[model samples]
Target chain A: MEFIAGKYNYWIYVALMMIGFYAMIAKGNLIKKIIGMNVFQTAVFLFYISIAKVREGTAPILWDRTVLYDNPVPHVLILTAIVVSVSTTAVALALIILIYREFGTMEEDEILRIQKNGSAVPPGKPE
Target chain B: MIDFALLFFLVVCAVAAIQMRDLLSSIMLLGIYSFIMAVVWTRLNAVDVAFTEASVGAGITTILLIAALSRTRRMETKQCVPPANLLIYGTVILLTSAVLLYGTLDMPTYGDPGAPAHSHVAPRYLEKSYEEVGVPNVVTAVLASYRGYDTLGETTVIFGAGICVILLLRRKI
Candidate 1:
């Protein structure tokens, strides 16, 4: 019981990660894959924030008579990571739009089929 | 009990988001998921991270997804998923999870004061941040002062991503 109680957060996040992973590979739509990737990234953020929590701690701000503060390093690092996540999401959505414009379908299998049959217009040519 | 509830709902949202055939619904569910995750971070005393998650994950990310969905199909097709592909993906995920679980077993317990993460540079920052940076918020101080270059790089990456999106979607080239 103690072991379970102590590490349940990790277990839950791992389960969350597996769900995201399954969606990434099992889902057919390109947008669904990107959603899965976002879920996976946020799960990792949860794990890091979980690690930074200190028992009987408050936020990492200097305040009167506050001794215990949560670790600030992870918070700092995750800020950068969150920015990166947003940037990547933007770029990925742009790519998805381009893929749809070119192949006329967002389904990964269909896109592959289009490419395989050589139906897609070649690069740098008007469709 | 509240943590368990939050986590349970989080997993539910994750599953529902993935399983939803409507891409817009999935995107909304994902936004909700991010909001809940941000709340969890706030409960964990990671206020700064929670704020960022709420802004980026729930706010900006959802908007971008909706914008993208407007340009693409909303419903996923019912084509048969191949068993061979499932098997390969399942094996890879299981192996990776196993390795990660093994690694977690040796990690310090949650909130251990003596954990390597809390013991090292964190202590110095917590102890000296006010004196050195004169900032009440240690997170801001560390992000802006100690890791200024990293934050600058992240800002540049966001700028680059904006440029890429404009270049890709604004023209047919």
Candidate 2:
């Protein structure tokens, strides 16, 4: 339908966000959660870019003659955000690697168990 | 028309994000949500905000997530019992939504020429920004000059976050 097609971008955005959030909360894998977080952030980026568009606006750069300019402020802000995101990602990955080194398995429950017990225990141990 | 549909999609995305079980799929959905938000910003004529949302929200953030995923495990090890604090979470979500909806009720109608925003200092900036700051974009003028101090503070906060993340993740040398 024309109505559906006209607003397809928004629909896609929502679908992606839902998928990411669900993955972050539902999946037990820490790596998968990170992926979900990435997808979530990307959805926001798509939203911001879509807003910057103008039907007939020109680029922010000025010409000798008069011209209607598309907004450039969001572009500048997004650049900064990108840098920050990269730094954050680096840090998050480092922490994840450390977690893996500390625990033989990447499973959350196993890590929790190790944390609670302080040492590996036999499977049948009640305590 | 389109606006109502967009709002509906937003609500649907929020619910699905909360309800989905696969963390990977949820992350992808979050990206989709951000994209929709960008479209909303465009509809509202806030082009600058929309640009920032797209590049940062969709591109960099997604990459970061993938990188993080590579460093961690990919599967849930055990089944987790649902938390007992459901009532508290439900209450919090409800209160926040109510407050947000209430705030929206007092907002100016979309694209109203008589709105306070159009009559304020913004008009002056729109007229004189080129002569005053030599910038073609009024949004940049406002961000870099009118609210330069706030921008500076935001930059500082970002730097601090970077430092904190590094400190937390870096192995002691």
True contacts kept of each: 0.85, 0.19
RMSD for each model, in Å, please? Answer: 2.6, 7.0
Please, what are the lDDT tens digits per residue for candidate 1 over residues A5-120?
A: 66878877888898888888888899999999899988888888988988788899989545888899999999999999899989999999888888888889888988899887
Label model 1 with its docking quality class.
medium
Model 2 residue B37 lDDT?
66
TM-score of each: 0.95, 0.63
| lDDT value, residue A107 of candidate 1 | 88
Q: Candidate 2 lDDT, tens digit per residue, A2-64?
A: 544344445455555555555555555565556556555555555444434444554444443
Q: How many backbone clashes are present in model 2?
A: 51
Question: What C-alpha lDDT does candidate 2 achieve relative to the native structure?
Answer: 0.56
Q: Name the candidate that leads on TM-score.
A: 1
- The digit string of per-residue lDDT tens for model 2 on B92-155 reads 5456445544544554443334545445654565566678888867777766876676578667
